[model samples]
Target: MTWSLIAKDVDGSIGVIVASKFFACGAVVPYVDAETAVATQAFCNPLWGTEGRLRLSVGEASTGVLTDFVRRDRGQAIRQAHMMDKYGEFAAHTGSECIDWAGHLLGVKHSVAGNMLAGPDVIEATSAAYLAGADLPFAARLIGAMQAGEAAGGDKRGRQAAGLVIHRGQPHAWLDLRVDDHADPLNELSRLWDVAQERFVHFANAMPDRARFSGTPTRHQIDEEIAMAEARRKAEGRGSRSHAVEFG
Candidate 1:
């Protein structure tokens, strides 16, 4: 019912993941800890969704967390999860009893996992696309990877919910977009990402942070940042549409 991936940026300062599944509200499948840059996914086990993130957020190692998860969960046979820690360690688990086409691919700083998929090609396409988009923006790279997976036959049951989460140097999400239910959730998620770049990102950049707890950029300053973002997008040959944009 799901396909997902977690990855760190080339510089290792940013982490993003995309998850899409056949269930409603499946967009919330990923748990990210920005402070440690740890991203964890728990598809078939609800406990790992919270407990796993808590462990990683509190400085536990990915292997240790995953080990404990497997130890404590009696239903491991149907579970699936993957983790990426701050040190670029990658780990993944796909239960033997999971549906056909269920498996995972772990890379140096990234991991892709899926269950109830069309075929193993889904993971292959996603991994290849992720590496190919190494130079794109972090969030864009994740979306592109998911796009490739969808092209290769995503969830066998079809899309219903999709999500993208990204975090940088702060404990809060730099970008978090979700499609709770949509005919084409991935494209909807991409559209929301573009909308975020138009304003939310500029606003987020000005929010108080560890280095500047009392700092808040003025409206004029935020406007400048927005314009700069738009300029950068245009320079990259991306369209400059303030609204009414569509994602294919």
Candidate 2:
């Protein structure tokens, strides 16, 4: 089974996707918010996201359209999926023919999933994490939820890949972090999230002065800033960690 958390940024303008699997599993989820965001997935339905976005662009209410789509899927009995849109509207389906013990759980702006966990407690923990308003990063929040779920009763199959995506302001992605294979995917995802933040900081720093400050920065000023930051980094023993390092 699968669970996904899709949300807009705090201002209600971005889109995010975070999910967990019992193993190599991923969601067959789909979503759309014509005025805000659109996303979808299936065991193989990549076009769900694209088509949903198009529908939103043409002026459709995300919830109404998604509800209609799911209800129309005669194949709804074939997969386990969840979805959320920019408006905070959400939906999920667990096919009758899905693996035994498969199910999904939901909370405000969040959904939790597990296929072979001890019971429904795994998803309950994830929902609780979202509802409790934890202070962790998006990935950490997801993993925290997963961990709580696991503590309650995780997958009988154990862990595998995990993914996190967040988008705010821009109709596209801001965070697309993942751990494709791992003994502990949620933990790896947490490490990758740290690396993603550091990469963003470096990218921000390397921006052309016009991009960073909205005005040309003198080459001298740029050099001085770089030197100062490098000095600080070295002094703090944070040296030589390149952007290429794999946090996962």
Candidate 3:
């Protein structure tokens, strides 16, 4: 019912994108932190979102985490998941009982997995788009990759919702957007990404960080930062993450 791409960038950013015929696909399917990324779908066990993340955070290897999850789950044959560690180690599981065309693929720093998809092209195009757009901002790369998957015929049933999450420094999400119900969730997500750069992304930048106990750089300070950041982006033809917004 869903497909997702989980990746960790060289800069220690972790991102996840999920699309599905199911409602609120993002809320349950993808999990990410500054250190690890995971997608759990195909008869998803929600516990993996929390448990798997916790396991990885505590220093468990991706392979070991997958092994532990599989050993404890009785319905492993119907479940699907893939994960990547901060060190770029990857692991995945695709159940035999899952729908046909359900599988996964791994790349330099990413993994693409889905079940109930239209065909192998869905993931193939997704993986290709992601690697091809290595120069894009983290959020752009993820959304564009998923869009390619959609163009290649995404969820076999249809599309209803989508989600993208990125984790950079803090324990909390660096960026998170979800389209719980929408006719074209992917485009809506792209629109939201555009909206985020307007103020939300810069606002998030002002929040308390590793050094500041109480988020400094108050209201007006944030406003100036936003304006200045935009000016800088315009000056250099850059956008998110100091790079131009170029989608594949």
Candidate 4:
């Protein structure tokens, strides 16, 4: 019912993943370790959802956490999950009874897993696109990977919703956006991300962070940062025609 990839950026300061499938996709398939930046996904096992993430948050190793969950769950044969730790340790489980085309691929600092997919090619395309877009912004790279997976024949049943969650040094997500229902969820997600960059990202950058406990930028400063971001966006060939004259 879902396909997802969890990966850490090259510099190790960011981790992100994108997931999509049928209704309520965001609610079911993703989790992040707020403290450690480990990511976890549980498919077909509602009970294992938060527990898996909790384990990772408490410093449990990825493989051991997944192994123990499988061994202890009575419905293990029909459920699946994949995990990646901040240190690059990874593990995945595809229960024996999951639908056809169910499996996972573990790569350096990344892992992809899905069930009810078009074919194994879905996973391959996702992994390839992610690695190929290493130079793109973390959120964009993840969306690119999801788009590639869709092109490779995404969910055999068809798409309905999608989500992208990314975290940097903060305990909360740097970007957490979701399309709970849409005809083209991934594309919608990309659009929303662009809108975020227009002003939200720059405004967020001005907010206080670890090193800047009282560092909120002045309104004039925020406007300057937004202008700089717009210039960068245009230079990168993604400029929008609806550029506003000024921010209120």
Candidate 5:
């Protein structure tokens, strides 16, 4: 009923892009954090995300977390999950009892997984797109991958929700967009992502981060950052087909 792409961004961030036939896949599938990112689906277990993140935060290995989570679960054979550490090490699992066309792929530092998908092509296309978009922003790269997956044929059951959650070198999300119960969730997600570029990303960039605990920037300073961000967007032709457009 779902598929996802979990990867480490070029900027050392972790991101998750997920879509499903289920409503509010965002509320269940992807568990994103700066230090580690995980997605648990199939006969879904919501605890995997929260508990896995805590384990990763405490210095556990991604492979260990993924294996341990699945191993300890009584319903392991129906579960599907994958994870990546901030350092780019990663792992994936596809339960034996998952529905037909269910499987997963692991790239250099990323993994693509799906269950109840249209076919193997869905996961393949998704992995290919993400691997090919090495120059795009973390969020854009993910969106493109999901778009490719959708083009190949997404959830066999049909699509209703899609979500993108990214943690760009922060414990909190840099961008978290969801299209719940939409006729075309991934496309709707794309539109919301573009809207986020208008101001949200810059504001998120200006806020106090883990590295800087105090002395938050002034509103005027934030405005300056937003201006600079806009200028960078213009320079790189962001939202268009361009390359290495780094801001925020």
Candidate 6:
């Protein structure tokens, strides 16, 4: 059994996450580029990933490309996946051959996951949440999708674990974060998402203009300050410590 999904934000960032009964679910299913993201699930044929991404790279509409690919695929054994480009275009597919309770959905900025959830309502709920459109980042959107799915009776098999990933301009890795191996995967994913926002701030602040301590100090002056501090610390019999600085 396999499950996978991917999404991109409005800011040209990419994220991909997936969970499968298969070990290392994250490794074989998700793919991302600077401009696009992809996921493949069910029998988890990784081929759809590169092929669909190639379509996106060539300027094909995500929905159309995905639809055609799924249609032509001879083996649709419960596959589910999502794709998005830097332009905010997106698409998703959930095969009819998926597990009895499996389904998928598409919405404004994201796509719903597919698998053995409570019922078809799982897809509806996730789709509704996406259409609701929260101001949160891509990670939150993913968690929201999971939450909706759970509320709608997610994983008739019962939840075992979850994960999340997001790509933001700076500090927010183009695709970073994970919360695998949990009893409450969606909630764990949310917790990781919040922590990721803090990372985003740290990354934002680490930019060239803000890397140094606040306030203007010429390069020479800053070097002098550093040297003076070292001298003073040494004179005060402080322990030997090296100092290093980066501009950006």
Candidate 6: give the clashing pairs: 78-98, 117-155, 118-153, 171-203
**What is the lDDT, from 0 to 100, of the residue 240 in candidate 2?**
47
Per-residue lDDT, model 4, residue 218, is 71
Q: Is candidate 5 or candidate 6 better by lDDT?
A: 5
Q: Which residues of candidate 5, in runs, are more than 4 Å off?
A: 225-248
lDDT by residue (tens digit), candidate 4, 81-110: 887754568888998988988889999867
Higher-ranked by lDDT: 1 or 2: 1
Better of 1 and 5 by TM-score: 5
Error of 5 at 38 (Å): 1.0
Lowest lDDT 10-mer window, candidate 4? 34-43
Clashes of 5: 0
Collision pairs in model 1? none
lDDT of 3: 0.88
Per-residue lDDT over 166-214 for candidate 5, one digit per residue giving the tens place of the 0 to 100 score: 8877777878888889999988888887767767777877767878865
* Minimal lDDT window, size 10, model 5: 237-246
Best by lDDT: 3
Model 2 agreement with the true structure over 46-132: per-residue lDDT tens digits = 444666666655656656666666677776565455555445555555666666566776556555544545677766776786556
Residues 52-150 of candidate 3 have per-residue lDDT tens digits of 888888788989889988999999999999998656788999999999789999887899999999999999999999889889988999899999999
Model 6 bad stretches (over 4 Å): 1-23, 85-87, 169-175, 198-201, 204-248
How should the candidates be ordered by lDDT, best one leading?
A: 3, 5, 4, 1, 6, 2
Which candidate ranks first by TM-score, i.e. highest? 3
Tens-digit per-residue lDDT, 1-248, candidate 1: 68888887766545545555655444456777663433334346656767776767677787888888888888887888888755667777787788878899988768898888999999999999999997888888898898999999988877788877777777777777878878898888888878788779889878887889865856889888889888888899988444565689
* Best of the two (3, 5) by TM-score: 3
**Local error of candidate 4 at 44, Å?**
3.6
